[model samples]
Target: MTQTLALVGAAGGAGTTRLAVEIGATLTRTGRDVAVVDAAYETQGLADYVDTIEADVTELVTDGAPLDSVVQPAALETPGQLSLCPARAPFERLARAKTAGAAETLEKQIAAIALSHDVVIVDTPPVATNQAVAAVDMADRIVAVTPDSERGADALARLSGRVRDVGESIDAVVANFADGTPQVADADTRVPATETTAPSQCPSCLDDETAFAPAVAAAVEAALDTTVELDFETSGRLDGLLR
Candidate 1:
């Protein structure tokens, strides 16, 4: 069966896009076809991961662009394909894409994408806009992505209410940018604060030695209910020393 999960941001810069991309990479390495669909129109941060974008998710949901055409596959050595359907649009189109009608179309568009892909991971903003609500509504599972801080936790608390308003609940929580085990309430895993690397070399979850690899793996297991091959032995400061 196909699985659809939304990684919703607890705050604006909660690293939701990064987490979604990393999750996609990890799933692809397991030989499962994965599509990281972007529903965060305003930020359009997912576009930063892909090399090029001839068309985007906005065009797909708003202008009726074909799914296969907008999907840009990443250059990964994994057995399964890792593709991104990101949104890169101006203010005008973005406004239209967030409309009630467009939000409904967005749900259908995501369902259509799920037909071909084994796993469809929606990169969503906080459940504020109509489109973001649609993303959550269409999702089979939902995970809140937040940074390892009090503000992130507070934002997460707010986000929980918003998600409940949309008739959904959070399946897991991932605390990003942590040196050790983060204390955020309900944080399933802690991803270290990794420095900026080339976009192509990113989703570093594929590398077992990376500090955040084990955390990413744990998130995958906890959120998606799957087993990860990577070991969670090296965590925190020692991870930096080994690498």
Candidate 2:
């Protein structure tokens, strides 16, 4: 069965979307079929970072579109492919979809996408939003991303408590753009910051060649309680990165 991993930003600028893309790309390089979903409706940042179809996640909740129709191949050209189910609609429109049975419908669409792929990486918006909460509820494991600052750490604690309150376990916590070491006792595993400069094209998407990618993939693997493999190209590949 496919596993869903939700990469959530505990606060703004935590590099959740970037980490999601990097992890998805790394998993692909390791020969896994991966699908990245943009659940960040307000920013639609994932769509900007990757090649996407005209449709968004909201379309999957409506009557006219099929899940595959909205799914597009990400630009990552690894031996294994990376696909994306992008969200491009305005926030108000997406908010409406969150009501009634539409959210459940959206969850079903996401579940179907998971069934077809080896792993599904959900790039969520900052924690505490309804969209983020819904994604967390659907996820098998949550990888909460935060910055190295005290505010970031505090925000992560709040988000972690909220997730646990709902009976979901946070598999890992990644501190992005860390200038120095950041510690937290709540995380099962903590990934140190690797990238300092931002990418020119997408603020969140990191180049696969960067050391950041491998470090994150290894950390996420460790969070999943699997043997950590530091190699990005060869040995540390998980059958399902989120599993």
Candidate 2 structure quality by residue, lDDT tens digits, 149-195: 78888988888888887678678776655545444434444444543
For residues 121-186, could you state the per-residue lDDT of candidate 1 as single tens digits?
999999999988998898888999888888888988999999988788999888877765455867
Q: After superposition, which runs of candidate 2 have C-alpha atoms over 4 Å from their true positions?
A: 183-210, 227-243
**Candidate 2 C-alpha error for residue 156, in Å:** 0.7
Candidate 2: C-alpha lDDT: 0.68
**What is the Å distance of residue 12 in model 2 from its true position?**
1.6
Listed in order, each prediction's TM-score against the native is: 0.92, 0.81
The best candidate by lDDT is 1
Give the range of the ten consecutive residues with the poorest summed lDDT in model 1.
234-243
Instruction: For candidate 1, list the clashing residue pairs, or say none.
Output: none
